[model samples]
Structures are given as C-alpha cells and as structure tokens.
Target: MTIATELASPSPSAAAASSASSADSASGAAPAVPPLLVPKGEYPRPDLDRSERWQSLNGEWDFSSIDGEARITVPFAWETPASGIERTWLEAATYRRALAVPASWADARVVLCFGAVHHRATVSIDGVVVGTHVGGYTSFEFDVTSHLTAGRDAVLEVAVESPADKRSIVHGKQRSIPRDDYDGVSFTPTSGIWQSVWVEARGRTYARSVTLRGDSLKGIDVAVELAGDAPAGAAVRTRVLGEGAAPAAGVATDARAESATDAAGGLHPVDAELRLTADAAGRASGRLEIGSPQLWSPADPHLYRVEVIVGEGAGADRVVATTGLRSLEWNDGGLRLNGDRLYLRGVLDQGYWPETGLTAPSDEALLADLDLARELGYTMVRKHLKLEEPRWLHRADELGMLVWAEPAAPSRFSPEAAALFEDQLEPMVRRDGNHPSIVVWGLYNEEWGLDWDIPGSRRRAEAAAHAYDTMAALDHTRPLVENSGWAHVKSDLVDWHYYEPDPATWAENVRDLATGVREAFPVKLGPDFVVDKSLYGSDEFPRTGVPLLNSEYGEGYTSLERAWHLRWQTQELRRHDRYSGYVYTELADVEHENAGLLDADRRRKDWGGLRPADVNADTVLVVDLVPRAAGADIEVPLEAFELTVRVSHHGADAVAGRVEAAWIAAGAPLPASPHGEASSAAVPAVSPFVLGAPVTLTIEPPAASARLALFFVDETDAVRARSYLDAAPVEAPNRRGARPAPTPAP
Candidate 1:
C-alpha cells in the first residue's frame, strides 16, 4: 500500500515551538464561555461536495482544557461563544468523539479531514496516532482506515494547540497584544477547531487532489494527483457534469463526446482516460473542450462541474470539482474581462461579523453579504487580509461577483515569519485557483508584515520582488500584486490608498495625482515609514503600462458630504484613462472602522440622496456645473447657468439610454410624467466612458437653489435599473451626520 499509516515525526525545533505555543495558550486570557453545543455539521467542501459517502463529525465532542474536561462543539472555536467555552487563548486541548464506520466500507480506505485547525493538531483513531498538521488556515487530512474496526464504534481524538502571541505564527488579524501594524485593524483572536471536520470512505486507489484551470470557453485544463498506484491496465476516467446535476455524480458517458451532450443526456465535457503505464509520478493531466460554453461574469456567474473517477465497479472512488470559464487580464493599459474593457466598481469586504469574530454565523449569513453587495451595485469585492471560506467564494460565483483573493498578512517580519508567509501563500492559491470569481491574487497589503525601517529600503523592495515572483509561479492564471498601498514592486497593478476627506483638496490632489502621490508619501507616512520611491526604475510610478487603481478612499462624517465625496471620487477616478477602477474603503463598518456605507450591524447609512445604484453603475451620468463658493448664501436668486452634463458607460456592452434633466425648486414635487426637455446622443459603452460632445444644458434656476435631477434611462421602463444624479448644495460640518434614509431593519 502506498498510503503511509504512521504520522511524520516532528523535528526538535518544531517540537520546542509546539511546547512554547502550548505554554503561551495556557497563560493567555480566556474568551467568553461558549455554549456546550453549537453545530456547523454541513459538508465542508461544497465546491467538491461528496455527501453520500461522507459523514459530518461536527456536533458534540468531549474536550479537555485548562479548566478541565467538558463537552464543546466540534467546529466552533474554543474562544468563540458558540463553542460553549469562550476561552480566548488556550494552551493544549484534546477533543474525543465516537463514530461507527459504515458497514459497506468494511475494507475500504477511510480518511478524516479537517477544514482548518487554529494552529496545530494531531489526530488519532481508536488508539493509534494517524497524522499531524501545522497550519491554521489550510485544510489537512489523515488516512485512518487501518486504525478503525469496520462496522464498530471507533474513538477519534484530536489535540490542538494555538499560541497566544500572534508573532509565534503567521496569524492574520487575530491579536492578543496590539502592535503598531495591527492596532485598530486587528480583531480578537480565535483558537481550536474553527472549521468543519468530516470523514470520507473511498476505495484503495483514491484520487487525492485535483487542480482545475483555464477558461471553459476555449478549453479547461485538468490535473489529478493520485494516492496509491493504479492496478495493471487500470485507467483514470474523467467527465464533466451537465448543468443542474449534483457536483459529485457526473453523468457517465464515453471517453470523450463529439457534442455538449451524450445520447443519455449527460454532459459530454472532455471525458477521457489516462493509461497507468505512463503515470511515473502518480499524476495525470489533460484538456477539456466544450461547445457553446457560457462565460462567467459579475452579472452572469456560470459554473461547470467535473468529476474524476479511479478504479472500476463498487471499489471506484470519485472526486468532484467546480469551475467557470473567464479570462481576466490587464492589457492596453486597462482591465478587461472576457476581452471586454470593464471597470470594477467594488468595495473592501473585511469578512467579519460582530458575534462570530472570524467565522460567519451560517452559510446564508455569508451569502447575505454578497446579496448586500449586489443590492448596493458593487460588481466586485476585495476580500481584505483574511482568506474566507470556500463556500463564500462559491457564493460569489453563483451571485456574479468578482473577488481579489488576499493572503492574511502577518504583523511582524522575521526569518520564521518569512517562512510562514511563503508556506501558507502557495496552498491558498492552489486551493482557490480553480474558482473563476478570483481574478487576482494579492500578496501583501500596505506592507503590514514587511515594514522595514527605511523608506525605499533595498531590503523591503527585495522582499516584495521575491514574493511577487514566488506567487506568480504558482498560479499564472490570474494577476499578482506585490504590495497594494503606496509601494509598487514588480506588480501587475499599482494601487493606492488616499483618504483625503475634503472635496476641494481631493480635487487638487487628483489634478496631479501621479506626481503628487509620489511626493506626499514620506510626509503622509512620516520619515521612518517604509515605501519605495520608484517602481522598478520609474521615479514617479511604474512606467511598464501597469494599470492604476485607487484601491481605497472615502471618510465623510455627514450623509450629504459622504455622498458627494463618493460621487466626486468615483467621477475623478473615471476621468483618468489609465485608472481602471476604484474600491471604496469598505462595504460595511468593521469594528472601529466607521467609514463603511453600511454601519457595524449591517444597517444602511443614510448617504443623502445617493443610492447604491447611483454610486456603482456601468453607465453613469455626471452633472459638473462647477462648485459654488464655500460660504455662498443659503438662498440664491434665479439665474441661468451652463451645466455641462457628461454621459459615459463603463462596460463594453454598448447601451442606448436617454438622458433627461429638470429644474425643480427646493421642496417642490417632481413631475409625475417622468419626462424632460433635452434629448441626449447615444452613449457608447466602451473603455473611455467620456462623451465626445458634452450636452450643454441651459438651466433657468428658480428663486431658491434648485435641485437639478438628471436620469440616464435605459431602453427598458425600469427607472431604478438606470442611474440618477441629483445636484444639491454641499453642506457644512454641522449639517453632517444627518440620519440616513431608513432601510429595512437589519
């Protein structure tokens, strides 16, 4: 048998580190006492779901802690209240559960899988140790067939250790003691088994892992890694499931199909077999071609399911995988999806809830965030710092949202820290690479872990360059970012974080953005800050034609000013041909970061007259009449003003929309007919959303400051489907903080 039955021995230093982590956990503070049982027993990997041959090991488990033995939930962390043991940082804990193997799999190989353990864990079945793993964010497995007696009660035990100090490992936002790099952005730490645990029964020759890639429209590449050697003359059978089928049970058919469907009506995706004679490395790979493939996009997220089966008859093992066909590239100095120039109207999603800490309350709870994003008109999300659950990524695919997958940044830099950073980065990309929604792989964020002493230091630059090269090699299917904030070191995209709240100052800054940002860094971040003064050899910015994006901006106190700021910032970014898109600071308030469009409890913040559809739309209409003086009178006499209205489309889908504007006195009702005076030329939807000829509307203002309401109505009669722009007087500080329009209660 090729599968090893013994657990790998730990090195002397690793053993010492484990002991130290245990000691730290014992000395740390305890979290609120979680309940005795709060189960998350669902199948962990829905992307490759195999529930028929699997059993959830999630409910109650006998746990032993510093406070003594107690019953705790299997998936919820020990520190989370849901686990019934609210202990913040615990030393070493042992979890024991009882289960009986299915009678039909008496001689089959049984594997136990854990989605994620906090830091480290050792697993044993019955009484023999089976396997061990040392990462908190990646999934791990153990072969437990030999340790179990079939059709009988078997005891499964796991010992987990989580270090109190985050510096001990590559702990991402989890904090016990706050540091400069972590402070307000970091959150409370969680420990123990924080993800699902389950068991799978498979044949002797099972498929261990499958890596899917490439766009489905052209052809998809598939590689399967096997466990144990294939018997003589045995071949590996692969098939892609027809739409609407359960992911695991792919339609059975011939080796390959000439059309999209077979005679039996099963999907005819590239079905083929690999002869074991050429499998020297226990790996098989091939390409799949499908006719009339559906492309995946934020508006239409379509996924294709595939299955790889090894062996034959009752002893066969099947592995399922889901993927979508979509190409994401930065070419001709702009971002494109499926060869169409597209702008990413996105928001930064922190992936934190007030009660769950790191984990969401349920799968639906996570889906609610996506639903909220779509409702707010955001096409994409930058999943900041934390790596979310796979189901969350799947939901993004189902809901038509794009994701920029970011690695969790460590707080400090050291030799061990560097090792940990590279160690986890590869698995993160490999595991999530098949998902079409993840278009970009983010290496580090704003230099959180690699913060060196000197600005533009060689050490920092070298480190970033190395990380970029390393991540690029693993997954060449998506764009790679070295450092997101100010420093640009060999990255596909150069992103910036500008939080200037004043509209006029912001306008001045954007006037000379490329240069003003370069010079303002040292002063903005202080002298000792760590940032590169040049990108490669370019003194101002990267001259490699890399796309530019304002990854973060916006912090206004009042509803009126915030709305205006969002509109102004988005409009300004759109003006620059080189600027691909912009992602606002956040979608919702996370803990103390109150700059979200929605508050901490997921409540909508009144954004004056602006709705989500207004801020994030493929087609937008902006009325730039020029700002009035800062201290202008509250009331103005009726006067004629030249309003230059610009109508532009951000997507490649050219649309026919009519523009209509009307002047209404303050507090006066709008006309019910929904008609206007002037007709707008057809707005072509393409890369540069700017209009060639601006529609100069001569507005005869009323006695008071009149509200100029403009609408970009589509061919359809749906008004909300179109974007509306309401021009109003900017408010002062005291006028800020007005209660936002009431939303359906959260």
Candidate 2:
C-alpha cells in the first residue's frame, strides 16, 4: 500500500467546521503560526515502486497551543521551533493538518507514512481513530483508503506526549539538566514530529520487500518477496540498469504450490510461490549476470539500478532499487576489500542540526555533509552511536562513502533492552545491506550494555556475536565489528579506544606495547583486573611492516594557540606511515568536549591560515631509550636543519625523562653545560614532561641548528638509550652538511 491514502484528508465540510471552531477559539488573533514545514526534497528511496507516487506533507500548517484540548501543528510538536508554539512544557499536545486526496489516487490504495514521532503518537482522520505508533526513530504507516472521503479534503490530527526523565525508551546521549545542562543552562525539551510526514499510492499485490547481496567486485544478487494473490501462468519480470546501460529484463514462471521454511523454522519464505490454477503453482527465479561490475569504493562511488515487475495474468507492478557491489573479509593480517588490503580513513560523525536537531532542513544539507567528507579526503566515517534516517545511507551508497553503522547504545541493557536493540538493528541492516558503502556493522560501543562482570560480559558478547551472525546470515556481503571498544571478545577485528595525541608516543608506547602484549602475552588482566583475551593471536597478527591504525584519537581541547598560530598542525601531526588514521574527538564542540574541528555554526575556525608540512623534506628524530646517562653527549649532523625530534619508550606510555641539548661545532666537545639549567637556550629541557610516555619535539627553522648535536640524560641511568636517524633529506647537494631549510612565512 502507498503512503498517500494513509493520510488522505477528511470531508471538506468537517475540515471547514474544524477550521471555524479553531478560528472561534483563537478569537481571530492570527492563531499560532507554525513554521513552514516544506519537504527538504523528494523521498530518498526510489527503489520501491510505491515511492514514486509519494508526496511530502512538510510545508506550512495551521497551529494552536493545546492548553485545554486545543490543536497545533503536527509532527513538529509544541516545544520545537518549527511547531510555532514554543511552550517549554506541555502535559499533552494535539496537532491537526488538512490534506486533500489526489483525484488520480481514486482507485489505488492510499497510505500515510510518518518518518518519526518523538514519543507516543495517536493518529485520527476526520476525527475517527486510524492508528497509533510508538518509538521515535522508526517509520510507521497506516492504510487510510477506507477512512478517506472521496474527492473531499480531510483533517489529520495527531496527539503526542513526551515525558522527561523516562528511561523505559531508548534515548541516546540526551540528558535533562536542572535549567542548566550546558554552560549552566537547563536542558530544553524535544517533543513531537521531528521528522517528515508524507503520503504514497500503491497498486494491489505490490512488491513487499527486496534484498540485494554481493561483494566489492562481484555484481549484487537480487532477491524479492511479493504480496497479494495472483492466478496461475503468471510471469515475474526483473531488470538491471546501470548509469550507461539500457535496462535489461528477465522473466520467471510462478510456482505457487512449493512450501518453504524460514531460518527460524517458520513457514514464511521471503519469496513464496503463487498458486495459479488448482494443482499448478508458479514461482519466478533468475539471475542478472553483470560482467565486470564497477566496484563501489570511497574513492569512486558507483551505483546500479535493479527493477522487478511481478505480473499477474493480465497486469503487473514494478519496483526499482539502487545497489552497489562490495565485499569485506578479515584474514590474520587485517581488513581486506576487493582482494586488496584497505585502510579505513575515517571520522566519527554525529549527525546533528542546530535548527532542526535530528531532522535536516533539506536533502542538500544531507548531501553537503557527504561532500565535505569527500573533499577533506576521508573515505570512511564511523557513524558514532546513533542510527540515521534511511536517506543518509542512500546518500552514502550514491556518493561511495564507506560507513561503519553503529547501534545506538542505551545506558543499561536488560532482556527487554536486548529485544528492542535487535528490533532496531535488524531493520537497519535490512534497509542498508544493499549499499556497498556500508562495510561494517557495529553491535556495541564502549561497554554500553549492562553487566560487565564475568557472566554478564559473556552474555553481552554472545548477544553481540549473535547480532553480527544474524547480519551475516541476512546479507553476507559485509563483515561485522562485534563491539567497538572495551568488553570486546574474539570477533572479526580487535577494536580499542585511547585518548592521546603525540604520534611518537602512540607509535612507540601504545602501538608497540599493544602489539607486544598481543604477541607474547596473548591474554592478561584488563583495567578492571578482569581476564581479557588477546586482540591478536600472535606477534605477527599486525604484520610488522603493515600500517597499525589508530582509529580513535584526539580528545584534547582545541588550543587557541593551535588555532591561531599552529592551525592544522595537530591534524598534520597525525599523518604518519605507522599511523593508519585517527578520529578527532568530534565534528563540532559538543557540550564539554571542545575538541571539535568546527564551531557550532559549522564554520571552520582557521580556514586558509596554515599550510601542511612537506612530508618528503621533513626530518623525524627518533631515540631508542629514555633517561640517558647524565653529561653524556651524542654528535649528529643536520641535513635540512628543520626537524621534529620524538623521544619516548617502545611502549604506550607518557614520556617522563628529560633531555638537555647544545649545538656543538662539527668537531668540538659539548661545552660543560654551556646552556645552564637546560632552560636558558631556545631549545630547553623542560621538566615534568607534558606528553604521554614518549615525547615529541617539533623544531622550526630560524632558531639554531647548523651541524646540530645534542646531549641527553634520563632521570636515572639504569638502561642504555639507542637513537636511530632516519631522515628524508632534501634533494639538494650544496646544502647537504647540517644546513637548515629555508623558513616559510608565518
């Protein structure tokens, strides 16, 4: 059934009478003016045949505050800006809108589709009860065909109630503060219809569901399930289309008599046979052989169109869907896609809007985000811990951006919680599986599920594994990340979380330490003293030469110094060979987390202010051990005077030692502590080391460094320190012997 009939208008006389009553109640005081709720654009999905006839019910609507059983703008709720009536709190609110059924949908089935409602929503047409929907994220539809008055406009009314401090439902990251949540201000309430409302028209016996499955290089396999009755000798036709290809079609005979069971031992085969005449059943099956399918990659996204037409004895209905082909696999090494090792360059994306909150203003706004990521050279994005509208996934598929789809985590998890989570997760996979851009299904994040103790941990892990297994069974095209961070078990990929910057320290301390433990000590006590399994089976798990990714990093507040003087320096420091990629704390300054790339208004803080360092000309100073013997000096020649020295342990820990340096001549002994107190010169040895275990020292030219040499000492002289020199010397012969590179304009 279509969404149109579901929201058909009430009788014209009834709407007029309701309008008159509303006017009388307002005493002609211009009533509350609801914000113009125009549809951002067309319906996101075109694959469904029913989507073609859908019309968005987004724009302007008559409204009133429901103080005493009054009416207001629908779907917008009373608290939101769009609702036009911004009451801080309301026990209950009613919203009404007048809509006329399209004359062309006289014979077709009409349906009303609501993208989402805040809490509990009850719908009525022409003052007659039609349907009710619970939950805030999932879409709901109603068959309004029987309730509509032919050729007359109808009144659609929705009543909504969203109470504060309710933990029964899943509300991710939303908090209620006593009149001061952020910057000492109370949190505002978010009520009613935060999404879109629309109508659709559909014919009888339409395609009910569809599944597209395939790998990166291989073409996708299409499977369909149809509903309604059809006679014998019916033909089911299917077509596949690409951007340049003319549509291709195939036909299958219906076989209605065959019986099949689903995975749960239920009698519902997604695709059922059609019984035409007595004793003769018909079923349609065929494959669309696509040769050399254009693989969908974050670098270059491509999509193909699949259309299916199920024909009865005389008539047929068609549904069209867009899908991409991609595959993901995990070997002993790491993640592989399309037979090649792929590194996920990703950022944690929290989809939010200032004006509309969760709902975007338009489709362009949605696509703009994808464009921003693409332009900034991010191929993948971890969707954080929230579910997005289906259209967001569609945009990813179309733009070719890889997605790590995460389930919204609740503070606690019970049996009921598990069931609700599964319900949301299953539909998410089903709706997005066809898109090649979605490569990973994330079940849990940061120990969100309740019960981290032994049995509880095991249960949560098993439940997460089951969810992944379910996704794999449903669509085996993508790999699953059982749990994102801690409380992880043996799953596809070993996921961990850390909040540190200093790349040198991360590389020497964290990365090397983690790798060593994963190798020699496969299992050990975790932070909570609980026995934890190894992230890798052996030392070779990470593959010594392969890139060890730091997926999550950077939670430090954006220093004003970094923004004004060292703009982009932090981001540039994160680009190293040993470093796969890092996700900065967030996209925007969220509450207390000021580590955002942009401000609240989405404007970049320091645009076109700084330039990235030239990787080829840059020199990286590496030292083996810390706390070198006091008064000990090492002589070294500088090629390109500009250098970034990094001192740290070979594990993941903060650098706690000290280093005192002096620029001795080519053959001169370092003067006895010429630079007194280590803090006298331009390059001083500061105490109480700032960075984690290993320290990173970035040196800019014009300071002091032609034939530079250094004397270093650790706090204690227990172990010998080794220093390695691996410099990417500039390709200039004249300036070879310890000469600094020319400084750039500040």
Candidate 3:
C-alpha cells in the first residue's frame, strides 16, 4: 500500500486554522477534549519538530486501572475524562498496545520517547523489558533499535504505579486525600501517562539535544550533544531559518516562507567542523554570527528561528528551535533585563483545568491562560509547584512572558527521595535550559520536600544548600532560589510571604525590611503548623547582597479587594528601593482559594460591583487614597477627599498619554460621559514612575458606596492604562469566603 504523493502546501493562515480545527471541534460548553478518537498525529515537540521522521504513540491503548480494565487515551492521564477512564486517586495502571515499526525506519536507530509518565513507569516491548523511569514530570527515552523486528508487529506494554499519597514522589498540588490542605491549595491527583509519547527515527549518528544561547554582543552559541558512533569528520552547521532575500539552501520553500522568524529570517548559515579527537566526548559546539542582532523584550518578543544540522547533506539530522537574544543580570538590589532595571509584576499560575486536571485539554487552552495574564498586564508568572509541558514554556517565550519555573515536591524527605530527585534534576535542567522565558529556577517551595517541623534545621539547610549547588552545576545561566518563602540556606535570592490585606500594614512591613529589621508578620497558620522563629528572621542567616522579595502576598476577600489590594501592594513594593519584585497569590481562583484577580475560569470579578479591567493596566495611573485617621473604623473612610496622581508604566516600553480622573457614585444620575480635566506626561517604562507634582482630585463619596477611577489614554482616546478603587458605606467582611466554583470566568 505504499504510494507516492505530492500534496500542495498549506498557506500559513490555513495551516493555523486547520491545526486549531481539531480542538475547536471537540471543545464545547464543557472543557475541551482532543478531537482524534485515536488521538495521536500532532508532533510532540514543536521546538524540534521533524514531522516526517517521527511517529506519535498517542491514540488508544489497552488499559487496566484498579477500578477495571478499559481502553484509555495515550497522552491524557487516566483521571481525566478525555482518557476514557475518569477514575481519580489512581493507585496503579497497566497499558498495553501493539505498535508497528515503519519499514522506513529499518535502517535508522529507533528511539521511543515518553514526554512524561506519572510517578513510576516500566516499559516493555514484545515481552522484553526496555526501560523504566521514576519521575512524573521529566521526559524519558529508550533506544529500541535492536529489539524491533523489521517486518513484524511489536507489543508495547507499560506498567505505571502512582500512589497519590506517596511521600517520596514529586507531586505538585496533587492531593492524596480530597482537599487536604487548610487553605485549599491542594488539588485532585493525576496518575499514569499525562503527556505525549512517540517514536523518533534517526541516523546512526544523530543529534541528541541542542542548547542555544545568545546576547547583544555575541552571536548565537550552539552546543550539540551527539549519540552513537562518531563520524571521522562530523560537522555542526547553524542556519537562521530565513536570511537575506534568497531563502536558505536545503530548507523547504514553503517552510521558509511561513515559519516563525525575524522579517528576513536570521543571518546566513554557518558551519563549524567539530574537532572530534580520539578521546572527544560526543559533544560539538559552534557559533552563528548575525551582523544585526534584534534584542528580545516583553514589548517586542523578536525571535530567531535556528536550524541545527549535524553531519552532511541527505544523511544530516536537522532540528529547529526558536531563540531570543537578550542579557539578564541580578545586581544592585534589583533585576536587570538587557541592562535595564526591571520589576516583575507576576501572578502565581498553578496550570490546572476543570476537566483535564494538570493536563491542558489543548494548546489553545495553554495559550488562553498566557493571553489572560497579558490582558491583566502582568509581565511574568510564577509557575508555582508544577513542571509544565514544554509547549507551555514555548508559548511564554513567544508571548514575551517571563517565567519562574518550580519543580514539584514530595511530602517528606528520605535517602530514596533525594536520589529520585537528583535523578530527575539533570534532565529537568537540560530539557528546559534553552528557554529564554525562564529566568529563575525555583529549587524548593516553602520547604515542602526538605523538613516539616524544624526551622533553620542543620539537616534541612544542608539539603537546601546541596540542592542549590547541584542546580547551579546544571544551569549557571538562571538565578536560583534555594527555597522560596522561608528556610533559605544558600541561594541567589531569598523571599518571604505575608497575606496581610491592609495597605498600611503592608507598608509597615516593607519599612521593616528596608531598615534591615527582621520580624515575622503575624498571620494565621494551619493547625498543623509549627512556630519556626529562625525561618522567619531575615537578618539571622542573611547573604550580603541577595535581593529580597515579598514573593508571595495578598489574599483578598472580594474582587474589589483583590484588585485594590494588588494595585496598592505593588505600588508600595516599588516605592521602596530595597525590594526586587512581587508575585501575587494567583492569576485565577483555584478550588477554595478565591484570592485570584480572575475567577476559576479566568473571568472578571466585581467583588459585588467592580470591573477587572479597572484594576489591571500595562501603564497604570496610580492615585494616593486618602489616609484614614489613627482611630478610623478599621475601614477606609467613605467620605469626600482630595488625592494626588502619578503615571506609571509597568510594561517594558515607555508611554506618552493624556491623564484623566473621575469619581462616580453607584446610584447617582449618570452623566453623558466621563468629564475630567486632562494633563499630558511621558511615563517611562517600569518601576519608577513619572511623579509630576501629583494632580489633586476633589471628589465626594456618594450617599452610598462609589468608585474612584483614573485613566491614561493615547492620542486616539483609547485607554492605555487605568485603575479604580472601591469606597464602601460601612466596614464589613466579604459577603462570602472561599468557595470552589466550576463555572467559567465571565
């Protein structure tokens, strides 16, 4: 049934639409499901997409879980509905399927790759054990070249064990018991294969992996790791996807025309003949110089698509990756991107979904989350406690969103646990090291896998320090947080969390950190929580110039509070010279933690009557709310007041605009439109604002509650930036506390 076919290539827009058609067809009022009933086809790694040479192992597989025996989808975990086995809290599962080895791959070394498998997975093909992997977050592969019989079907079997309550395995937010944690941060557990799996056919000598790096002054530096026999004169060639008026040689004309790249692609291709000496360890390094380098920033995420070709023509193995040229450094009490002092306005993203658990139903779902963060004007996202799929990271880089990647943690510490973590760390670092979006590697969070009851325990500190050193050994480019929040041992940065809602109290805490007076912020810890004084002190075990951040903060009771709290807190943090940055509690509400600016489904929240857009802006117009008297009722006084305004641009680009301010009472007669006097000012990008002898605003709080609003608009009157604060009639707790809702955001 072999046939030769020449199909017309699809246009860029048509191709994009066609790719999205599958997910769009399957998605409905409910969360999306993969369209393919047999679910395989799409290339797993877009970064190294060699579509013609790879085969997907997704589709249907014979599955057996504790509940019963049934068929399940390959990539979706057994717990998700899309897997055709909606069982949660899974203990173990066995998957079996017959795989066909394409005759085309007979001469090449066949490699089986698993994007990720939960907890533990043991693989066997045709009754022979092939390999075994233990971590749930990192990808693993096995060379099955010798085991494959040329013209026969191969039986592939995978046995997976994932106990939700296992203390030795790294599981992020995956709860053993339902809603186990006090604050409701814990979530439903996932088990079995939860990501793509495939087979790659490569030549005898092939490229194992590629690492790309670049800066303003230097050309693209590429490091290629090879596998198998080394050729006598193997060479590494680097080519920018599309460079000059003429397309690159050997590249597909259609691909060169439609692929993502700079306007004219990248600089011309450059090849370096590797010095593979008698004892040369399978490694090749080279550089591709571009005369005119385009810098990457949040405002303009310019990317250069690079193609790394190993060996000679026809037999050469080719892989592509998108890279950005930029420099980052941490010094002088702040972070610098491309030598510009930057502040990270980020939200904690858990990467969870109502229907799919940790697995995003589709690529669009992942993009939607990043797009929502962009709309909220957040420059970064702290991927808290979860090792997300590479596609998610790729999207962040494409969208110009910065990321703080964290590894999932186990419940308790042990020798076995440490060994498993160490085994997983190397792959994690190498797999993601090439990403430009990731700036920090968060080693441990709140000491989840280190120690439970000990504060500054020698054993725990040593463990944290060891982990830090190990990570540094693997990746020296990114900043490392030894342990986030408390109990920091050896790290490039240290941070602490506080959930205080009052702006004044937040300001007071900031002053304490600025003056080097370390003290704990009193807040309610769970019943299982223990008092750890040393962990709370900033000065006790401090490093000389490590930047301090209020990394985690703000849990508001209402939507109004959520928006107001973030605005005021961010302003306060930036006002001080000592603090580096801040990441709010979350981007969207998760389970019972209703402290997000957006609700569970990523919708606008009004507390009872507020718009999400009002509190979110790329370039915000900050106004000083009138301070209450010393004895004022534990609430912001609802009275007429005068305030000053400052224009601040929080994005990576400067903005020039007309500023407008107004106060609108909830029940007052409506005016034709917002009528306010305007002034012009140029707002520089990030951190420090243009504080032009603040314009005073005189407004009267209505007979009831009201909204004080400020907006900065461009020449066309389109709002470039905006902010709003709520005025309440009386001091009262939020109408409701945290409640889990499955409804999508409005």
TM-score of each: 0.83, 0.66, 0.82
| lDDT, residue 686, candidate 3 | 36
For residues 546-581, write the lDDT of model 3, one tens digit per residue: 777777887566675565566677666655557667
- TM-score-based ranking: 1, 3, 2
The alpha-carbon lDDT assigned to residue 646 of candidate 1 equals 64
Q: Please, what are the lDDT tens digits per residue for candidate 2 over residues 1-746?
A: 00112334465345434433443333222221222335554664643434535566766555444455443443454565655666655646667787655444444445677777766778888888787765655566675766653345679877776656434344445443221112121124456776778776544344555677656355556555554333234455555643333222222111211111122243221221222221124334445556656776655677767766665332244566777666777664456677655556566676665555556556777667766665544567787666666777888887777887876544455666655555566556555667777877777655454433323555666666666676566655665666555444434665555543333444444545334443211222243343443333233333343323444555333443222212122323333333333444445554344555566555665422211121111121233322111111111223323334443222222223444434433324334333422211232332211212234333222222222333334445221122222112233245557778799999
Give per-residue lDDT, candidate 2, residue 711: 32
**Model 3 worst lDDT window (10 residues):** 1-10
Q: Give, for candidate 2, the lowest lDDT window spanning 10 residues.
A: 611-620
Better of 2 and 3 by TM-score: 3
Shift of residue 196 alpha carbon in model 1, Å: 1.5
Cα error, residue 221 of model 3, in Å, equals 1.9
